[model samples]
Target: MKTVEKIERKLPVLKTRKRVAAYARVSMESERMQHSLSAQVSYYSALIQKNPEWEYAGVFADYGISGTVTKKRDEFNRMLAECEAGNIDIILTKSIQRFARNTVDLLNTVRHLKELGIEVRFEKENINSLSGDGELMLSILASFAQEESRSISENVRWATIKRFKQGIPNGKFTIFGYEWQDDKLVIVPDEAEIIRWMYAEYMKGASRIEIGRALMERGIYTRQGKPWVDSNVKVILTNITYTGNMLFQKEYCEDPITKHRRKNYGEMPQYFVEDTHEAIIPMDEWQAVQAEFKRRRDLGPFGNKSLKLSAFSTKITCGCCGKHYRHSGKRNTAGEVYYVWTCQTKSQKGASACHSKNIPEKMLQNATAEVLGLDEFDEDAFSQQIEEVIVIGDDTLTFRFYDGHEVTTKWQSTAKTDWWTDERRKLWGERHKRKDTNPNKHLFYEFTGFIKCGCCGANYRCQSGKRKDGTPTRSWYCTGPKDQCHNPGIRDETMKRLVTDVLGLDEFDEAAMDAQIENATILDHTVTFHFRDGHTESRDFLDKRHGTPWTEERREKARESMKAAWTDERREAMSERIKKIRSEKKWPNP
Candidate 1:
């Protein structure tokens, strides 16, 4: 063999150069940090180029990003991807903390890289990731880094709350009418005047909508230069800040990882600093405003009708349509104003949707006066004592008193016109030139308010048609859309058939039914009637929720949320929990 290899022969085999990349990061974007990051990039580039056995892959740097989260670091993710693609042999980072402060994330990433035959070398730690003890050291050190970050966050939060307790504002925060000057809230004169006017107007019975409209009409914009809406006006009115009071800890960050802010409603302590700034509204007036707000809210739906609304206005509910009767006025040419309450659903959505007719407000009040056993009921006293007036059918009124007493009274129908009737035309028409300015109103069915809509809980209105002979024909329907109600309307004839046949009622007596039935709720596929005796019954119906298909945006959002929920950190935590549980207990059999 030696004698045969006398001639000179070359046996050197070419070796591929190791592709090396570097990663650098700074948590904050300070001037010093920026320079440090730039220096790191330059150093890594020079170091890789100068190495004969290594090839310069790239240098990845993230600025103003936290080292704890790997998801938000763009450059770091890119380097990891390159390493997995076999484009990089080794990753050189300043230290383990610079790579990742989260121990789980760092360990997972390092283990993943090791499996792919890629190495991570921490310069400061002088640790090679390919070594056996690298991960154990990395996990311990990274955990310390995570704790350090948490400590800093906790300390900052503590300082903020401490300052808040001392009535010293932590930082400058801008509001509509005030600016922070040297940690003191100083009101802008012009804005303060606007706030004062708003409070005054609200006390004078102007609604938030009215106040907002007035501001918009005057071309007055909010501090943010946006058109003021009702909500904005309401916020300004409700804010105690305008009353020279400052409330702190109204909101808080949920955690450092997610960094989501939530309204602090009893979740934490709040500090109230009174007279912290110049008052836009006096203390007495603010108290009065709160009392008024409570009064309106306690009254439920009726109190929200109108700001300048008089006592007892729109306080009556049309039982058939489940809508508050709207107050209407008509002139009688005698210079007298005749007020009547019309069904809102009937008026807005038309008679087809709601057949509930109008009721004379004056006549109804007289009956109420009689029920209260008073010679004459004052509007103020009546409003205070009366909880609500539910008008069923055309003439029946169910009055609920504040003292928990209920009274049902019947009034003469105003729809039956005596002057226009053919039988009485000869007698009364000749006296008034065959025309009566005032006409009687009569309802076709007494169940307009008696029978309520199972869907919207509104009263069933009486729908009648006039035959050639002038006799009445009637049916019923729901006017849900007019009242912004989602439940579909049911025909009165259908309800009557269902009630009389199933419940075995005599004349479908609403008064008797009202005494026995608590409520009737309708869903997509069934109607559940709750009786006063706690008995329940359900009837099948077609499902309605299967209308619209899933939207593209909704589908995409679901995918992204699913991915975010199964993050590496969350996965590791779940895995470790499972491992601990497995080590603690073992099942004997399936």
Candidate 2:
């Protein structure tokens, strides 16, 4: 227990000798107002020091800040701290509203200062906090000030909402990839390149995580000169602003009293302004991206959010614990934030389930590409290289790999590769096997190889892919018997329709494909094979010789002969077929 410090000196005597401090606040830090604040501080210090009856404590002014809220005004808080430290006995301010426009805040703060023997004087209000009944009148006036402040805030919001409904562009945050000249966005050539790269990568089936890494690797930075991040890339992908359009009032204050802003997709009228700014992404590309985003969004619960590749997620596979890593974002300078992938297992279980590990988004993307055997995601280069790999396998058909190794264009190299020995063939097959089993698998050329009727000598062109159109005319067209399989080979498109129909894949998009793959475990028995061109053929492998002249006797003899044959030629053919079958295998788990 300690004895209380008594006020041995009376207020009249103290008022004549006590150090007096003053506080002031200005809403903006304009040159003129800054000068005025400085003058006030100097004047008070000089006036107090010159007076023999008073001592100069200090003049604290919060410049370029609001007085309505004391929380953000550091200068005011410092003065309060000084008072608590027993450095000053009195505080002088311009008015009650200036002291604090918040009624509750004003009263509580003044009452606190008074208890520490620090009296606050509102010169305009002609009231001192320590005087009897002075606080009662101050609270009533402060309440009026607070109410006035609320009225101002409401008017601002109403005006903003009105402007939003009118499709007016408002606010100060500048859009990246565009320069604002005369209040309109114009494409900044350099920044626009980065934006274009983002959309291009995304359209080429790169995920947000991949896009972020690509940007960082290219020495590209955000509008704020910081490293790229997945969430930031996602935002860039989703923002219609890059399409030269915008939605005004996408978010609004959820709590009018507390002023908490939230997405107002349901509550407010959304205004879309198209071609309002110069485009960073083409309208067609933007449409494609948005279509993809909506398709992913419709996947529900298991949306593309989970598809994000965090740094740790790509490299670290859970041998026992199967939980995957997750990603998170944080704000940095320039009001931008970066995202990082982290081990969600550790985050949730606190090292019980897994260890805490994090990886940068860029690193993950590079690792994934490398794992997928696509060390360089240069589309042209990849296309050329893969084509080169395919051409060396067969020469009679003139089938060209799009990987730039066109047999016709690079015939000399193709001829050399075709002469690969048995050992070389085995090595090539092994390399391809490794590529297929890579965990960071990319969906490039997952469909490919073989569509021919052996009996007709009719080499049908088996298309392994299709266009975006929802028709079945795209699959295997009998180029006609070079040409013996008389049945005009089915359309590649028709093959996809037939296979999808049988597999119940009604949705014909990447998202649908992803879903089919995910549910593959449940439908693992519903086997099928997808061609490199995106055509799917059932894995039933039935021997249906439609074009063969198969009399009953000949058919029986062929089957019996096939069973007994074990020559080196037969073995060689079987080896090639086995290699091809393994090369063309798919999860079919869906």
Best candidate, TM-score = 2
Runs in model 2 deviating more than 4 A are 1-16, 29-47, 165-167, 254-259, 298-346, 349-590
lDDT of 1: 0.76
Please state the error at residue 171 of candidate 1 in Å.
1.4
Worst ten in a row by lDDT for model 2 = 388-397
Model 1 TM-score on a 0 to 1 scale: 0.45
Count of backbone clashes for each model? 21, 31
Model 1 C-alpha lDDT per residue in residues 345-396, reported as the tens digit of each score: 9889888988886877667767878988888767877888898988888778
Could you estimate the TM-score for every candidate?
0.45, 0.49
**Against the hidden true structure, what lDDT does model 2 obtain?**
0.63
* Candidate maximizing lDDT: 1
